[model samples]
Structure formats: structure tokens, C-alpha cells
Target: MRYGLAWCMSTFGGPIGQALGLTLAEGAYAPVAWMLLGACWIAALVSFLDGRRRRRLLASQTGLGSLRAVDWRQFEMLVSEAFRRQGYTVRETGLDGSDGGIDLILQRDGATTLVQCKQWRSQLVDVRLVREMYGLLVHHQADAVKIVAIGNYTADARRFVHGKPIELICGDALLAMVRESQAAGTVSKQTRRRA
Candidate 1:
């Protein structure tokens, strides 16, 4: 969605601008450089602002630790940002509504984890979803799998992940993790400044 576009624009902006600078002019190095620099700066700045805005929204909305108050898309982004704060590189695979299999893929310390976010409101997430994600682990080559549910899971679903590599973060646990991740990020920033 917008996140993917923003990331792509930010990531390619610098290099593409530089390339344009060389191709657009023959000897006008000064003008080209200025324009390219401006382009690159604007792209990077917009991306930074968007990411900061999303992160701030994530923290502020989760302050109450209530998941039902947020919209479905926001929940997914919130989950993504929470993991990002926890020092995991998170990538959103698909767009907003059509997230084929996994919503997020996380990597940290050379370990990869696939995450499927379910905004089931008050409904109990079924075992079928969990089993589908488990099947995708090998296909995605992930070290583990996690299911993030805004609501609770079915009894059968809970039993399914027992002794399995799949970790289910129910509503309560998900909120706690978000709070913990944000707190960890705060402490990390403070420690860096003190050092």
C-alpha cells in the first residue's frame, strides 16, 4: 500500500536522482547536482516523516492497551511497528486488504520469523488459519511463525499450537508486547544518549 510505495520511493530516490543528474545534463553539473540533491532530500524527508508519524500513532493509540478501539489496518501497522521497535526488521508482504498468507516477515540476529496478523475483533480465530501459516513456514523458509490476533483464539486453535513453533499473541499478550517493545525502545534511546 502506501507503506510499500513510501519505502520504495525512499530507497530508490537517492540513486535514481544521482543517475538522472548524470543523464539530464551534459555540462551543467551545478544545476543538475542541485536538482538531484533536492529530489533525494525531499524523498528521504517525506519517507522519514511518514514513518515517524506511523510510529507515533502506534504508540499513542496503544497507550490504553486496547485493541478494539483501532481499525483493522491500524492494527496491522501497529503490530508491524511494535516489532520494529523490538529491534526486528519487519517487512509487509502484501497490500492492505489482500495479504495473501503472511502479513509480516521479521528478522533479528540471523533468525527469521513469519507473522500473520488477524484482526478478528471479538471472534475467536480458528485453527484453520494457524495451520495454513504453519504450512507456509517451510515455503517461506522462516525459522518460526507467529499469529497476532486482536481477539482470542478458539480452544482448538490454542491446542493446535501447543508444543509447536507457532507463537500466538492473543489480545492481552499482544498489548503487553506492544507496551514492552515501546518501553524497550525508550530505554535503548536513553542508554545511547547517556553513552
Candidate 2:
């Protein structure tokens, strides 16, 4: 379950609570049912609004300058959305509190890829960070590891993944991906409208 969904469930008790409340609605319990139903509605609205906000953020990323303006969590969401557009099933790991774990897990054609997103506007990703990502790839037995950043990577970081199953996407390269994904989304929407 996603972190947001889990939190919603804990706070609102979700559809199950709504159903139970409805079934038990009587002279004394009617108010409780209405309250539970209202809570569920609020949770659903919040989830929908959040998803819309993330989509808007991804669509507005036109360049490295725009990318740099996003927060770390938004950066992760943007990367995840880009990969999803490329046909990967993306799962956000919700590790925003710490910088030590994988931020997204991508699966396509039975191969898994771990993604680490860095919203470092002024800091270049160094070889040490690339090495740590490589270690995580090996530890998780994943097919590949991708580190996406708003800035660039050090030359040593680029060299470390020369022949490895690690990809360092940063700066212009990352911007290109976001652009391609955005173009693809637009084309698909147009196609759907035509049909």
C-alpha cells in the first residue's frame, strides 16, 4: 500500500468503515455513519487533488531551471512519472525522510530497476554517491540502477558506471527525458481524442 493510502486508511478507516457505518445506521448511529462517509469523501478528494498537483508539476518541467525549483519529493514523482510514460510500472518507495534508500522501484518486462532521485541544484553527484547506488543494485539483485539529479554528475561518477548496469541521468539528459515523456503524453492524449 502507498504511504498516502495507508495514512488515509488509518485516519478515515476507508470504505470499510463507511460500509459498516452505513449498515449500522440507526436512530443513534446515523450521525456516526454520516461522519464516516464524510471522512471517506474528504480522503478521496485529497488523494485526487494530490495526484493532479503532481501531474501539473511534471508537465511544467520545461528545463533544468524548472527542475531545480522542485522539492526532493516532487523530483522523485517527476522521475517516476517519466518512467511510467516509458511503459515501466513505477512504485514510489516513500523514503523522503531519509536519503539512504531507493526512492522508486521500476519494473518492466520482468526486470526491476531501482531509482534514486536527487534534487541537487548546485551540488554535482560524486563518485561516492554512484558507488553507493551500485552497492544497492547489487544488494537488491536488481537489473539496473538509475540516479536522476537536477544538476550534473562528476566525471568520476560517470566513469564508475561505464560498463556497469548503472545509469546516471542528470542535467540536460534528465531534462530531455522529461521532455520526451511530456511529448509522448501529449501525443497519446491527442490520439485518444481523435479516436
Candidate 3:
């Protein structure tokens, strides 16, 4: 019963599930339940594939102009997908809202790295943001902290991160990562096709 409730909630939700909960258990409506579940799964697959396509499109574009053009959410998604391709287990934190705090938690080789995505257009990432991330790093005891920006970092920001377990990725550096991740995805797809 609990599992049925969970499935109904996930597949239909709210009033629809409430109305169908009894029907779902009825022998006559078993086909209806299966059909609705199949539809839900298909929608999920399409949504996942579409998001992958959008991430690939974002990665294939060259230069910071393309990066800055995406909204804050898409920018974060692009960064998350890139790191995932680069072998990190990425978790989107959605902490401190959409535009601030640790936006991603990356795990690789038993080490956890917290990431902050800054999609600033004209301004450089300043020391204040770096300092805050450092504080988070210490508090969370993460292996490292990374700040990914569409623009460059300020001199103070650069100085603060030097010799620390913090990596600042911006401008050309970020573009290189995008390109590398994009290429990695392509190679894997080709390999799978050939296999």
C-alpha cells in the first residue's frame, strides 16, 4: 500500500492521485495504472534527454559570450554537466538560492569538492566570494572548493586562492574545460556506437 501510494504520488501527484488511488488497486483499472506509469516514465526519459541536449549545445559554443548569455540556472546546469563528464559525481545543492553559495557538490576518488558558479557578465569575481567559499570549505571540511565564473577573477581573488585547495575557473580556462568535457562526451558516444 505504501509503495502504491508512493508510485501514485510520483506519477500523478495531488488530486489526480487521490482520485485514482482506489481505481489503481481495482482489477478493472490495472491496465490504466500501468499505462499511466508508462507515460510518466516516458516523460521522464524525454526530459532527461532534452536536458542533455541543451547541456551539449551550451558546451559546444565557444567563448564567454555564450556562457554569459545563459540564465543563472542554465549556467549552473552547464557547469554541473561538464564536471559530471570529467568524472565527478555531481550534486546540485540549490543552496542559498539560485545565484549564491555552494551550487554544486562534486565527489571523485573519495574526495568531495564544493563548487560555486558565478555567471557574472561584466564584473570580475571578487575576493569576498572567494573568502566566503573558503569559509564554507572549512565548515564543511570539503577536500576542495572551486569557483567557476564566466568572467575573470580579481587580483585579490587570485591572491587569496593561491596555494589553497581552491581552484578558480574563468574565461579561457573555463572555455577549455567546456571544450574538453564536450569532446570527452563525444568520444564516449562514438565508442559506445562502435561497440
Candidate 4:
């Protein structure tokens, strides 16, 4: 918005100035237009690079974006990294192999969120899993519960959390997060540290 508005102003201000009988220098318009164009170009370049990095992050999550191809561990790591990119300090609790239902804890803006990364691709994730995550919210003292599933959830699963603080992240929603987190940072699958 910043650069775009500058671009519009510079591209039109000279003509408007002329119409209003403002005596601007002849060479003024070109330089201002060039400057505005440069700024817009830079913003465009930055946006493009950020978008490309985010796409890469989303694609490599499942090794070419196929959810079924990824193991549960990789999916969990991907969710953690995604949260990390979104300015959250993500702590991976699932690595201990006995996390008691919580996989990742995301802390940001003085709020804590518990995330359960469920890569249940073979079958629909049901209400039991959602209930387990909800139950941990009080035990862990978390502000919210998020179930990040690579696959879809059962209708019962969705209905269980209606009017609740539980957030269900499926494939499309996860991709949206990847896009929104572009400014956060790029994540390399190989160098993605556990947790």
C-alpha cells in the first residue's frame, strides 16, 4: 500500500499540478516518477522473493506437497517450523515419544497455544483426538488449542469444537498459514531443527 500509493501520487500529481496552474519544474515529474517506480519495483521484488520462499516451505512439507508421502514426525516438524516462521516461539514436546497429547507449544504476544500435529492421512481424524487436545488446554494452562492435521477431519471432529476455542488446521488452512507467514522467514527441510 505504501509504495503503491506513492506510485499513484507521483504518476498523477504532475498533471494535476499543471491543471491547477502550479508552476512545477519541467524535469520534476520524471525524477519523482522514477523514484516512485523504483520503490514499487523494490516492493514487488521483495514480495516475489518472499512468496517463492513460502511456496518452497509449503511444497517441501510433504516432499512435493503430497501429504500422504510425509511421515508423522516430518509433519509435526513442519507444523513447528511453520509456527516458528509466524513469530511464535515453538517448543516441540512430541519428540519425547510420551508427550501425553500435546505436540507443539506456541508462545507469542504473551499468549500460549497448544498444538497437536496429527498426520492421520489414512483415516479421518475424529472427535476423540480433538477432545484430547481440548482436555490439555486446562492442564497445560494454554490460551487455545490447535489441531493441525495433514488430512481432513470427520464431521464429528468439526462439530465437537464448534463455538469453542479449538482451532482445526487442515491442508488448505495450513497452506494459508504458510502464505501468511512469508515475512516470518524461510525454512529449509534439511536444516529444520527439531522443535
For this target, which candidate reaches the highest TM-score against the unseen true structure? 1
lDDT of 1: 0.79
lDDT of the structure predicted as candidate 4: 0.73
Please count the clashing residue pairs in each candidate, in the order shown.
0, 0, 0, 0
User: Which model is ahead, 2 or 3, in terms of TM-score?
Assistant: 3
The alpha-carbon RMSD values of the candidates against the true structure, listed in the order shown, are: 7.8, 7.2, 5.2, 14.9
Local distance difference test, per candidate? 0.79, 0.83, 0.84, 0.73
Look at candidate 4 and give me any clashing residue pairs: none
Lowest lDDT block of 10, candidate 3: 21-30
Evaluate model 4: give its TM-score: 0.61
**After superposition, which runs of candidate 3 have C-alpha atoms over 4 Å from their true positions?**
1-36, 39-43, 95-100
- In the range 47-113, model 3's lDDT, one tens digit per residue, is 8996777667655678778877888878888888889888999888863376348899999999999
Which residue runs does candidate 4 get wrong by more than 4 Å? 1-64, 182-195
lDDT of 4 by residue, 60-129 (tens): 6433266556677666766776787777998889967787898998999999999988777667889998
Q: Quote model 3's TM-score.
A: 0.77
Order of models, best lDDT first: 3, 2, 1, 4
Model 2 lDDT tens row, 60-157: 98788888887777888889889989999988895456645689999999999999888888888999989998999999999999998888899999
Q: Which stretches of candidate 1 lie over 4 Å from their true place?
A: 1-26, 29-31, 62-65, 192-195
Estimate TM-scores for all models.
0.78, 0.76, 0.77, 0.61
Worst 10 residues of 4 by lDDT: 19-28
